[model samples]
Target: MSLIELHTRSLELAAELIDTVQPEQLVLPTPCADWSLRRLMEHVVGQHRGFAAAARGAGPDRALWRDAPVGADPGGAFRGSAAELTAAFTAAAGTPGRSRLWLPEIRDGGPFPLDLAVGFHLLDTLVHAWDVAAALGPSSAAGIAAAVEAEPPLAGALLAVAEVVPAAPADRGPGRAFAPGRAPATAAGSFGRALALLGRDPDWAPPAR
Candidate 1:
């Protein structure tokens, strides 16, 4: 319910998703058409670090997160990014209500309320968990639920922002229509399926693959 709880839960789900990735599977295609597993992971870690940076008062330029930046060890790089995000968020949680975050590209303008920092990350973590879980098969539902339960605020935010701005991860491709307060006609196959209905799909499966 709180931002800190949401951040922690998102981190936990993300870790679970990361654990599902085999070394060989890292190169495998994911639901997100343009991103392989590795790329999707990179994007996740990058967004975390970027958001943490903003919460720490650093803007996009100084943000530690980068898009597919070369690393000495790609795997280690991913882990490091996750770790960095965890630390940043942990510190932000300590401050509570006092910390600030800004993302001109995502939000309309100006920094978001210091309070909404965790809520923003919460939505990202939950949706991405579904993305990774769908690619890995049915084993990730628990993690998905964790993300969903951790961020009730995110659901409200999603309803508010669904049509206003683009959904997260940027790699999810085109936006789909979603009618607030209405469920889709078909049953959701997975957590990612539910996310797709909401106009967010970080792990959209590529048809060709």
Candidate 2:
């Protein structure tokens, strides 16, 4: 599948997980330490908008990257952002040189290629969808399935652009996007292996209330 297709699938999976979030679960802790579900949603929305702006040739403006406000209607807010992101990506497809993306923190350097930017975001969406599922606990069967379904396509897309993605450094520091988590056992399926590669424990569940 194309990067755009993978991104679309990832967004759909993310939306599925977001839709399952109970109001009370907003404050729950996720695999991403220090970020509650609510905060994580905000971050997701922010990233969607930021990437949309980048695809539009408007550099990754810091203002566009600002965390979205997770109001009482978090799901609605996220859906809106996701829709905008999809539209922007669709419009930018096949027009690589038309715009430049500003990604200062890129492992290789600044100013990322259009395809690389899109692929990186696709990878992030897939992993974060799983993060949401893990936070929601085992009862979210539908969410879990959606996340699992997204893994292969997104991971394949990432591999297509792996050269741009920075390897996880030895130090699992706060700023790092992924830590070097323990490798998944061979028995772990594609989804589980993808999560493990992204530094997430596939079996992670929320603490009992």
Candidate 3:
């Protein structure tokens, strides 16, 4: 499958997970340190818009990267942003000089290739979808996410990317791409190992609520 296909799948998975979030659960903490589930979602929605802008050569503008408010319908907001990104990326794939476009929000906004730009978003969607699932804990939402992860194509693509991303450095914390690495459990599957590579514990559950 294409990177766009994988990215779109991740976004869809994220939307489904978001749809399962209860109103009271919005304030719950997520794997991203210091960010509640709502706050983490704010960043995810903002990132979708920012990346969409970048695909169209307008990414240098910082305003698009601003944290958006989690409105009354978080799932709706997530789907909207995901759709925007999907359209932008589809359009960008055909646009002339797309390879020259840059994504400013990534590592000092270097002039990375278009494929890398999409890959970045794909990776974010994969990890953050897991974050949402983990926040929801052992529920229908998590089961939904786990079922999707069991698909070889999706997990394989994510694993391919995760394996290449180096473990987070000692200074790792909020604002960095990933957290400190954790050892994968002996019984871990491909998806579990992938999460481990991305500095998340597959067995993690929310604190007593």
Candidate 4:
């Protein structure tokens, strides 16, 4: 599918996941170490908002988008933020799509194309959504399949990043394994495995399972 479709799908999955967050789970710890479930939701929503601002040709400072504790229930906050993000993204994608962005990840004080920005958003939401699901427990994996399908660049980027960066000690976390310094290899198996290779695990299976 095209990047827009993929992004839309990711957003849809995000909406579904967000609606399920219970108040108690917000403070739960996740695979991301320091980020609690509430913090993770904040990160996810805030990032989407940042991306939306970017889609509108808004250049945002990193601090402006930093994660914070969720005041309301995470699910409700997520729904509001996701809607805002979707609107902004839609507005940006509606025109000729020639906006430039300042994404540090791509190392461009970018004047990047709109499609590229949306693709980046898709990749990010996919993993972070799964991160939240992991904290919530087992009923979360269904969204991973949709998220994995949304971003082709994630898989490709992982392979390329691995080829360039030397692998670290094997026990390092999944995220570290695909960092720029490691020359790792592409993983085998499903899209989930591919995501794992890139340092995002779709299987974030329950700790007990």
Candidate 5:
């Protein structure tokens, strides 16, 4: 599949997992160590807004990137943000001279190539989808894993980005997008290594309650 297709599938996966979140689950602990599900959802929604603005050359604007908390309807917020992001990316893909867009929130406020920028968003969407599914419990994670399997193109492209994600140990931590780095498991598959590189344990699960 193309980059746009992979990104679209990732967004769909995120939306699907987010739609399953119940009101009570919003307070549940998530894979992101310091964030409740609600906070993580806020960050995800904010990213959609930020990236959309960046795609339009309107960004590097911190306000758009900050966590825009939801009121009573986090799911509704997510849908709107997702649609905005999708539209922005789709438009950018076809427009000339928009190939190198400015993204203020990214490291050093990048003017990254459109394809690379989309990959960055795609990987984030996929990981956050996993985070939400994990919070919903193991069955949800397994179900989403199966859903991803049904779309081989997305899974393959997701791993490709994960395995080659650009980051250094010094660049990861509490205030950053990724957690502290762990030693990569040489024997593991690309997915496992990718998770490790992304600072997530390949076998990580929520604590048993």
Candidate 6:
């Protein structure tokens, strides 16, 4: 799948999971430590906005990347942000030149190549989609399936970017984004391996209430 296709599918899966979230589930714990479902949604919305801004050549504008507020209607808010992001990416799909993405989190604030930037976001969306599905507990078969479908494309996208994207320093440790984790013996599928590569325990599940 093309980067745009992968990104579009990622957003679709994310939106599906977001639509499943109930008000009571907002406080549920996710695989991402210390991030509640609501908090995770905030991060997702913020990233979409930031990426959208970057696609529009406003990569350096920090203000456009601000964390989106999760109001009472979290799903509605997410849908809006996702729509904006998808539109931006779709609009930029055929444009010339590499898209500049401002990534302040990295050591050198990067205006990274467009494909690389989209691939990075695609990776995050896949993993975070799993986080949400896992948080939804054992009943989330559809969500799990969506995540599984996302794996192969995600792997392909990451592999393509790996050659151009510099490897993180060894000393960066396990907590860094994209750090590999110990894959559980039971982690058999592509999604599981992808999760392990992203420093997530594929076997992780929310504690039973």
- Pairs that collide in candidate 6 are none
Go through the candidates in order and give the clash count of each: 5, 0, 0, 9, 1, 0
Clashing pairs in 1: 31-203, 31-204, 31-205, 32-203, 32-204
- Computed on alpha carbons, the lDDT of every model, listed in order, comes to 0.57, 0.71, 0.78, 0.61, 0.79, 0.70
In terms of lDDT, model 1 sits at 0.57
What does candidate 6's lDDT look like per residue over 59-94, in tens digits? 476677677887777779888988898888877766
* Better candidate by TM-score, 2 or 6: 2
List the RMSD of every prediction in angstroms. 5.5, 2.9, 2.0, 5.3, 2.3, 3.2
Stretches off by above 4 angstroms in model 4 are 96-98, 104-109, 146-190, 201-209
Query: Which tens-of-lDDT digit does each residue in 12-94 have in candidate 5?
Result: 77787787677877888888986888999999998899889888877466887888786667778888998999899999989
Q: By summed lDDT, which 10 consecutive residues of candidate 2 come out lowest?
A: 158-167
CA deviation > 4 Å runs, candidate 2: 94-96, 105-109, 139-155, 158-164, 168-171, 207-209
- Preferred candidate (TM-score higher): 2 or 5: 5
RMSD of 2: 2.9
Candidate 3 structure quality by residue, lDDT tens digits, 93-185: 998887655666666677777777787788788788888887877574357557666777887777777777756474355667787767887
State the lDDT of candidate 2 residue by residue for 1-209, as single tens digits.
77678778778777877886778889988988788999988888888888888777776457877788877667788889989988887787757574457754344334776677777787778677777777887566335644454566665564444333445474454777776655876876555555666667666666667
In candidate 2, the residue pairs with backbone N, CA or C atoms under 3 Å apart (3 or more residues apart, or in different chains) clash, namely none
Clashes of 1: 5
lDDT: which is higher, 1 or 6?
6
For model 4, residues 1-209, the per-residue Cα lDDT tens digits are 55666667667776777778778777777867666777778777677667766776766466646664557677667667777877877776676743556554344347667766776676676656767777777567555554454555544432333333234565345544232232223544344554454565544553553
lDDT ranking from best candidate downward = 5, 3, 2, 6, 4, 1
Candidate 1 has what TM-score?
A: 0.67
- Work out how many backbone clashes candidate 3 has: 0
Better of 4 and 6 by TM-score: 6
Tens-digit lDDT string for candidate 1 (38-59): 7777777777768767767675
Candidates 2 and 3 compared by TM-score, better number: 3
Compared with the true structure, the alpha-carbon lDDT of candidate 6 equals 0.70
